[model samples]
Target: MTMTIKKQNRAAFLGAIALTLAWGPALSFAESVDDKIARAMSAAPSDVSAEATIMDVDGTILREGTNDWVCLPGVGLIPGDEHPMCNDAVWMKWMAAVGAGTEFSTDVIGVSYMLQGDAMVNNDNPMATDPNDGGVWVQDGPHIMMLFPNMDMLADLPRDPFAGGPYVMWGETPLAHVMVPIEAK
Candidate 1:
């Protein structure tokens, strides 16, 4: 009887595995194009996101826009988090550089909106994966980020996020940018 019970349990487990394998792809693809666009639009103001291009994490263009902005599903090293962001042209190049591990420099100012907030990340190191590695980690809420051509402009801004208001993030790195918080985290 024990052997029969064990066999039945094995069959049940196999059935469960089969069901999961059959339904996984279908469930993953269930998110519609309209849904992706809506999620991407949540990153910025209605005026900017409404006409901005909506792109997915895999560079799939869900919606083409008439403006110079590109909205994505998320940013940073956080896993499984959907912190969408609306980025202007320069920010896009910055992101591309970050993704490719290449040097990035801009001659003009850049802007990125994350009104929906953002995931936790190291303030001084963009490549740092572990938050407890002696780096200042911050999870900002409803913020706008500005990138400058001149690094000297960031010399006076505070680097501490707890200091409140605008501060410098990744201050010691080439990817340094100003973090302007619009609301409390």
Candidate 2:
């Protein structure tokens, strides 16, 4: 009876330790907005001469920059099918450095410039009623903007006030904006 009890206690202690070790990385993955922004900026190109700015929920500018892409770090940009707008290669690199594992939803604003290939394609998601088609394609110029919400104030506001505008414009030609959510490894 004594030997059995000793073995059970040892097993329980080892299990607890194993569980903590496995979850340690995930616990550290919950990063702050500032950390994410810094990571994104570090990955961005220095010679492009673009700017990055982070805004608060009240429309106040928290941080601004003069660089290639203005990123909100962990935020996503949704592009419509009509006018795809973004460099996928560059975006992928940025997300990778920021320790992926973030969730971003698409909010399509509107459909301007009625061209032949500019018609919005509906992916049949009723929640996305806007003509922008919820970030399906890249040709749809600056349609998607990443949102960084103030967690404390978000619950009290009647509507979502964290709607963010585009930070980076992918040159002259508006390709498709692809906001791929990265999972933290």
Candidate 3:
């Protein structure tokens, strides 16, 4: 009986070692909380990101802040993509709705900052995952986004991203917003 117990113990120890060896590299690649906070803060200007709460893509709060803005380390469907953004309260509500796959509406204007630029996305369909899907695809650079209560107000804005200024993205959808480019891509 003593010999059998020793054998079992040795097997368990070996299994633990194998598990560690298999997973160690993946675990090491995980981002630290401090790193996530730093990346999130880079989404907006110093004035907004300094007092903005840092959050993960899964809605996990990484760091608490004093202001109404919330910053995120990444957004979009691209694997390993880091398109950080800082959003105000109104945009937060809109984001929640988007995540929950529900309709979103607001009575006031909302703002979001993506000073680090954004991942490539189909500007007409928020659900589009492929860039080559024959849709209007754009990869904006260092821009601010605005959402209004009435999308009808966007009727006059240029829908083309290369129009040289602010334009309407997702114009036909309820999630339509104005994209104000700050710098060239």
Candidate 4:
């Protein structure tokens, strides 16, 4: 009996070691800053000048720019998804506020373009299947998001994601924005 137990323990230990070794790269994987920028830039129009500033997904300014447009890499939302976005300066400022978890209100309207979205994520509870007013997920491709200063911007827009129209995201929060799904080309 003692020998059997010892053999089982050794086998378990070896399996654990093998699993850890297999996950080594995934555990330590961090996208390079340059690669992040490139991926993020792919979300923008090719006509965008090289002068646009590149910002980290964490809101850190990677590169300063003279243009009002700001670009950022994917922030790792959902699983197996990479949805990068290009934002105007106002949107970038708003993004910073959102990342800081602070309440911020502004009347200035702004626009962001996402030309390479992998999948749409639930704006409220990321992991929850309920409380989703904008359906569950978007099955489309590139899209644009608009930040409204107030309810007026909503303009009676449907909150349904499958409405084949614009919908409000983060409707339960003060940072609500209109999500406009674009047909993939």
Candidate 5:
């Protein structure tokens, strides 16, 4: 009788697992993967429409283009924040350096647009434990981030409030990028 009871319990557990697996595809994707890729690519310059290549997070080809730009999803290392980004080849090269834990001088002026940012946290998330630990969460609204060709070029950008735009982000690090807030439609 005990053996029969154990077998029944195991069968019930397996049934539940099977049901979840069956429903996972429908439930996991809020939207189609192709739609997600298209949305991510829209953050880039429309002029590059014919020349831009887009790929999903898994490195699968979604749409083919002829330009030097690539795009991906990023929300400043934060979860639940949906900020898709499009970056030129120059910026992607810089990203490779960043990934290898090394720094490299920029060659061509690269640009990345994150016009869909949900929030711009004022500080870096140093403590990996708390993604939002660094500073106040400012809904600075939608914005575009720029990658300068020269590291020293940052100082040359307008710092005065009257300049009406541009702020230093990710301070005191090579991971820094310029944030320019824009009016979201």
Candidate 6:
């Protein structure tokens, strides 16, 4: 009987380790800059206006709203239009989170979305310009998505022709923005 119990314990420990190894990396990867933006936008509520800008590593605007801007690195800035992927639920969550006051900053090429700014409810860290505090914040082909808290503030609004849906927030901040990765052209 003792032998059987020991065997079971050993099996359980090994199983736990294996499970962690398999899912740990994927979870870490999902915390990337692109995933952060996608998740934030995915949790946003519909009807809340927001804008996003996507740029390449060199700060070049690859694709802008209705009109693609000149690919001038560190020169041009593009605005995000209504993305088909940005559903109503996503908009609501993001807006609500922002309204609730959550300051967020992410690493452009790394994992871990740090909470920063006066809006942050849990972690009241201020936004810093340091490389550790600032992520890539790019919007190029590798970008997944980039959402803003106040998109309705735009002068010339873009078109959003998608049906409304439910917004869901997973973490503490619902209004945080994200950046997704796409196939590099």
Taking the tens digit of each residue's C-alpha lDDT, what string does model 4 give over 1-185? 00111223433533332232221121114777677668767877856625666655444455665666767665422333456778774565455454445565655688888878646566554445444565455444778888877767586887667777778876776677887878732
Please list the C-alpha lDDT of all candidates, in the order they appear.
0.75, 0.27, 0.75, 0.59, 0.53, 0.25
Worst 10 residues of 4 by lDDT: 19-28
Expressed as tens digits, the lDDT of each residue in 1-185 for candidate 3 is: 00111223433533332232221121115789888789889999899999987766655567777887888788733445688899887776666555445677877899999999998888888779877778888999899999998888888999999888999998988779999999875
Poorly placed runs, candidate 6 (over 4 Å) = 1-85, 102-137, 141-178
lDDT of 2: 0.27
The total of clashing pairs for model 3 equals 0
**Per-residue lDDT of 1-185 in model 5, one digit per residue for the tens?**
00111224433533332232221122124767677676676665577534666644433445665666666544323444355677665555455544434564554566777666644454443223443455533455566777775567787555332245776666456766676878632
Lowest-lDDT window of 10 residues in candidate 3? 19-28
Give the per-residue lDDT of model 1 (tens digit) for 1-185.
00111223433533332232221122126778777788889999999999997766656566777887888766533445578899987787676656555677887899999998988888888779788788889999999999998999888899998898899999988789999999875
Structure candidate 5, residue pairs in collision: 51-66, 51-67
> After aligning candidate 5 to the native by TM-score, how far in Å is the CA of 162 from where it should be?
13
TM-score of each: 0.81, 0.23, 0.81, 0.68, 0.64, 0.21
lDDT of 2 by residue, 1-185 (tens): 10111223433533332232221121124655555444434423433213544321111233654432333222222221112122121332323222222332223222111111222333223124366545332222223322222233223322211123222222111222222212211
Q: In model 3, what are the clashing residue pairs, if there are any?
A: none
- In order of TM-score, best first, we have 3, 1, 4, 5, 2, 6
Candidate 5, superposed: residue stretches over 4 Å from native: 1-30, 73-81, 118-136, 156-164
Stretches of model 1 off by over 4 angstroms after superposition = 1-28, 76-79
**Alpha carbon lDDT of residue 179, candidate 6?**
29
Task: Put down candidate 6 lDDT per residue, 55-106, tens digits, no spaces.
Answer: 2222222233221111111111112221213222233222223333444332
Question: How much is the lDDT of residue 182 in candidate 3?
Answer: 98
Clashes counted in candidate 1 amount to 0
Residue 156's lDDT within candidate 6 is 34
